[model samples]
Target: MKQELRKQFGDEFQYEIALNGNEALEVVDELVEAGVNVILILSDWLMPGLKGDEFLILIHAKYPNIRSILITGHVDESAAERVKREAGTYAVFSKPWDSTKLMEAVRICCNKN
Candidate 1:
């Protein structure tokens, strides 16, 4: 995924991939251990092992300061409602996303960090 993003966004953007939530959490923990403060998290909502919204919930519980954005290809109304009702997400984007707007949103959110 990062490879594709690199190809698409070039050197202006940085990216990292985590095969699962544990790995992602490890990376986040390590960054925190390094005394770095991160602000934005962009996650897919249908990951294996842990659902994306659930992962965001966990992250919110542990790191309430960070802002999270969730992307989902799923169109289930109930799931959307659940995410909106239960999670502290910055935004929920559906599949076939608008790259320009997404990057703009990232830039806006990242500027605060």
Candidate 2:
């Protein structure tokens, strides 16, 4: 996924990947330290540490301006609704996502932010 994003964005955007929530938080700190405004997070639901929904909510609490998109292969309807209501994510795309749609959503999100 990281490689695909890099190819799609090239040098136009900065990309960072973390294995878990704590590492992701550290990356956020580093980006802030460098004066980068993180506009979006594309996350998956099932992770080793914090679940993706939980992780996104954590970030959102700290940085409400940063939009989020959840990409997951496994989640129930109730969970999806919870993300929409609580996390306030921009969108939730399932596995085997359409690349064009994802990019379009990203473009809209960036423009809005």
- Least well predicted 10-residue stretch by lDDT in candidate 2: 104-113
Task: Report clash pairs, candidate 2.
Answer: none
Worst lDDT window (10 residues) for model 1? 1-10
Scored by lDDT, the top model is 2
- Per-candidate Cα RMSD to the true structure, in Å, reads 3.0, 1.9
Error of 1 at 48 (Å): 1.3
For candidate 2, what is the lDDT? 0.83
Residues 26-109 of candidate 1: C-alpha lDDT, one tens digit per residue: 877887788777677788888878888888778877888877777889866676666656666767788988876676666666
lDDT of 1: 0.73
Model 2, 1-113: lDDT tens per residue? Answer: 77776776777778899988778878987897899989888888888888888888888888888888888898567777777778888888888888888887887887832
lDDT (C-alpha) at residue 12 in model 1: 62
